[model samples]
Target chain A: MSSVGAAEDPHHLAHGHTAAARDEGGIAPKRIVVSYGFWLFLVSDIIMFSAFFAAYAVLVQATAGGPAGRDLFKLKMVAIETALLLASSFTCGLAVIAASARDMDWTQRALGATGLLGAAFLGLEAYEFSGLIREGAGPQRSAFLSAFFALVGCHGLHVSAGVLWCGTMMAQIWTKGFRADILRRLLCFGLFWHALDIIWIGVFTIVYLMGARS
Target chain B: MTDTPPDGKRPWQNVWRSRIRTSLSYVDGLMRSVALATRRHDGVEDDAHGRAPGPAAALDAGGANDHAPGLDPVAHRASLIGYVTGLGLAALLTAISFWVALDRETFWQPGVAVGLCVLAAAQMGIHLVFFLHLTTGPDNVNNALAVAFGVLIIVLFGAGTLWIMSNLDTMMLPPVPR
Candidate 1:
């Protein structure tokens, strides 16, 4: 109604008016909007990881006459890594619980625990990589090693990022006093941390479990 | 008219003045248009931030003075239960996978492969439901949709790669004389 042109285009005006009406009625809360968007991003990330998984699956048998998974893998080390990662996921969930309750002390404690566990997992992984490299079974050794490092190493990078994010969230909550925005960020971090664990499960079963046997 | 600087000492004053005027007007016009576009869409006044009420804040505004907590405390407790269940299930699944892999000789190889895949899928579900809190409720439909789409893409990618690459391998690899 601001211009004669707007009046002339009744259909456009009507569409705009209806869209405004829908905004009033159908506007989602911020949590849903943010979480839904983040969920999509996580899904896209998983899709990218699937491409890597497919490559690894195809190349798993292609040791190129070099040492295979059974010759190189240490299941005990992998098992410990899995346990550490799983415990961290659980602690992350606890952090979410504490954050939701506005229990600052518990939230910090849980986040600290989660970070430590994540650090432990990364430490073990670094040790594994160093040992493997020491033994000359590094990524360049064979197609199998290449795929192995690509998949597991990518996961390690994510965990590293998650640890950093956890630390940042703790600092934010400490300084900001659990403001709503900070809480929202904490929720996002929790989702990210849990998604990493889900991906790790895939890595464990497919790469570690199946690879050793195959 | 003399084309001279207004200050009478600086030769570039007039030129600089014109340039500043042009830039200021440009910025003013930009601000006006942005204001117009953002003004009163759908009969509601847009806040300066132009953001809608988020779930937690909206609920807080609805007179639930105690809603400042991230979500319902009861729900948090319930989710704690979910976390425990998920952790136990995930741990059990990992143990089974390791057991199957380490034993190596008891089950048929292909059967073991199939079993591992199944266990992995189940563990992923536990994480999604328990850790991520993804559900099938109407409020969670979008999250569920995203997850389903991701699964579809992964299946297509993995299956397609295996099929095409395996076939190519058979054709390309030189046959060894037995």
Candidate 2:
């Protein structure tokens, strides 16, 4: 831990400088602080999701003999949704890279791709939910369904917001031309989109795969 | 340091003792140097920004960060290869998850659920590292610390719920034969 003092400044810390210790006042360049603060937001967001996850896990078996996950989950559809989200996450990361370079054209392209893929994912989800409701297995049917809807629906809501964010970022870049503030927003958007993919990993594994396995 | 050991000390024990003593002194020296460096850095932030303190002052020339993830974006500077690799690996993990769930016979029979969980964990880790770019680096200590705390909370919350709920479920009468 003492080795951290060797870093000449926090910026050098990025290069793996052997021992740059943050000063006592903890004064940092605004960017690092912002990056870290946004991460905290993302972490807090995940913690919120964990509560929903706990609820879902607890009530997963309380289906009251209504349609359980195995009867309703379609693995084929889920696989497609996962692919779409995973692809969007990847595109979002690339958009950040392009935004960092201030490459307006490619940045716009990547962000566009991210928004489109996310929209497609949400479309599939809406279809799935509607189909379930059509078959009388909606959230009102049982505790299990309710938990599933709440957890997965919350994530879908986040993705919807993220998609909207991506669109707005594109417009801002178009008008502002990769301004410093715009780029920062892009990075945050990247983090948010990636974080959503991570949550979906949990949802698919527990709610869809495990629920449908039997 | 304790003069000399009494009888029962073997030759290898003497060697081990020396190795430990040497490492401890090395660590001690490192700590001292770090302490000196920290003091040196105390009044240097402004100077580092204003003028070149030494030969390396030419750096830090660009990129004032915004209030939102700004510093990290400039510091880390997202790259093409990393995002591509992350995407490929994530896609592969998703494939394995679906494969394991949909078709169990071709793969190992037992523990399908366990395998799914393991795959999910691996995929989450890949996403965090590649897409999120959280690191154990000195600059990224805050990110690491924040995430560690968050994960601790999540594990405690989820695991506690499952444990308590399952126990309660077991204690309840079985369906009352209705």
Candidate 3:
């Protein structure tokens, strides 16, 4: 079937019969293409993060005899950050369930919760970055500092984007309800949000934890 | 608009047709695997079948049944709880790692540092598998594949860059002036 035909077929939307049939029959072109497309985008995102990680690793020791991670990092603060991000991921999963069920209110609530948690995480990160800068451990102080700022800042930027995306999705749910396009967007958002959480795990491990020791 | 070629002769048509054929083959292979796995486990019957003999016989013999065709709320809730718990645990682990790194004087020993790094990587895998649900399921195998490919590229490039640059710094850079 033509891609446009597959997308527009009301049969596909009616009780999702078409989708079920395609799955059962092992012939779902649209699903495969959509899946592949999302994967391609994910791969590209990973590449972007890899570049940042590489830079950070290269500059890990540029402290100029300044205060190192051992002195600057607050385990309590990082714990809070991790909690916020992880909670946001949980809420994100709830949002996906809501979307799948076509429960607009639950979906909006979950998305809002996700956004708030994500924003809280971002706020903590910004505060951490600022605190470092205030203590004269700014990115300008060392090569290590620069890489640290860039890598963590890049992640912070993604979290910010997720917040904005959640807010927009909430608005869309309110306006358009749980339409296919919106659900697709939400699925993609879920993937993106979870991917960030996975990457943050690396950050917590490599940059903060390991750097503190080294 | 003037004159379109026949469907069989159109280049775009041929390309799409071939793509569809290839995708069908892939799906066929996946379905075969699912069938084989299911068949391999088909002989196991639980005690529920033994206790409810009549009901079980009726079910086995294909009798009337009320089927609620909709989302499974309990499964959904269970999945949500699992994800929440996983995330919470990951957060706790991250905090502990940070604490150990900051407080323990011997934590920077090369072996210890490498162990810590490996722990972090394992934490990442936990988040992916438990929280993100990136695994080999009917709905998510493609996602899992994507993640695997992406991770491969990131590891190769990130580790390679770090290794090369660290070597360069040691060999090429002049000693720091006192």
Candidate 4:
């Protein structure tokens, strides 16, 4: 049968009439539509980060006879930054759980913790960047430094955005209560925060860890 | 409109009374409409005709515990476990990644890069499943498809750049003297 005919056929509905079929057919909830759109946005963001990763990988060896990754990387500091971010992601997950359970106080507390951890992570990153620049190892020094700064700085920027978003969400929940709209926003924030952590893992491994060794 | 009063009272008095009454009714109607709109937006109405509750119904439902369809406390508890598990695994993976990178003497130095990549991919998967709630159910199939397409694009972009650049590195340079 043709695709249109199949859609019209009652048999099609009978064989595992999943939620997607019903939602797509019409009457899909606002939450589903918004989240799907948000997911698309996240995917586009991942593509952009992937491009940055590719650039970093290509120029990793192009240090222009200046300081290389091994000369500049501080594994102990990066480890602390990684820990802060990982902890923040965990707390963000807890916030989501509290939101799902409709527990207002716990949600606020978890989100507050997540925000603090995220702030600490950003602070360490800024310190690291400033230190590197002070030592004349800034992005302008070499192609390798340029790519390194671009990749890590971009991830830091995302973390900064996540911190701002977390604060906004706390205010929204305070004023609006746990309304469905607020809940949807919370869900999106959780997704965004976790995705940032994932990207950081990539950055830590490829840029910090691998670069130091190579 | 006639200026003369219908009743025996003063014309201006009659006109003022009528105008005030009309404006009062208009204000009353406006208040009622606003109240109704708020109720509808509160997200309390049931999922009629397979529809999810609207946002305003949330307030009408009276409390956060009044979850809509498909969102219950039991499921929340289960998801909590998933989140904790994801957190623990992610921490473990991060530690392992650091260890492998830092301690070059333990593992073959050449394989560390590949090992780190594998660990990073695994951590990403854990986050996607636990934190992002990405899964294979019907409701999430579209999300899965979108993510899959994204991964394909990322792989193509990354791999294609490496391939082209490495080729250029070989072909663009003049032959080195023996």
Please list the residue runs of candidate 3 whose C-alpha ends up more than 4 Å from where it truly belongs after superposition: A1-32, B1-78, B99-110, B173-178
| Candidate 1 residue runs with Cα over 4 Å from true position | A1-25, B1-78, B105-109, B173-178
Candidate 3, residue B39: lDDT: 42
User: A124 in model 4: Cα distance from truth in Å?
Assistant: 0.3
lDDT of 1 by residue, B1-178 (tens): 3855566646576679899999999767634543443332323422233435443334323323332112232222223556777888889988888887777578776788888888888888878877787766545677988899899999999999999999999889687899
- Fnat by candidate, in order: 0.61, 0.62, 0.53, 0.56
* Pairs in steric clash, model 1: A30-B54
Report RMSD for candidate 3.
Answer: 22.2
- Per-candidate iRMS values, in order, are 11.3, 9.4, 12.6, 9.7
For B50-80, candidate 4 gives per-residue lDDT tens digits of: 3443422322233234322222221222244
- The TM-score between candidate 3 and the true structure equals 0.69
User: Model 4: per-residue lDDT, tens digit, A1-214?
Assistant: 2233344554665563444334335655566677788899999999999999999999999999999999999999999999998889888977876665556787899999999999999999999999999999999999999999999999999999999999999999989997877887987898799889889988999999998887
> Candidate 1's error at B72, in angstroms?
5.9
Report lDDT (Cα) of residue B21, candidate 4.
Answer: 100
Highest-lDDT candidate: 4
TM-scores of the models, in the order given: 0.74, 0.76, 0.69, 0.76
Report the lDDT tens digits of candidate 2 across residue range B1-178. 4555577687788899999999999767544543443343344432212332332221222112221221233234555557778888888988888888889678785788888989999999988888888776545778989999998999999899899989988898877665
Most accurate candidate by DockQ? 2
Model 4 TM-score?
0.76
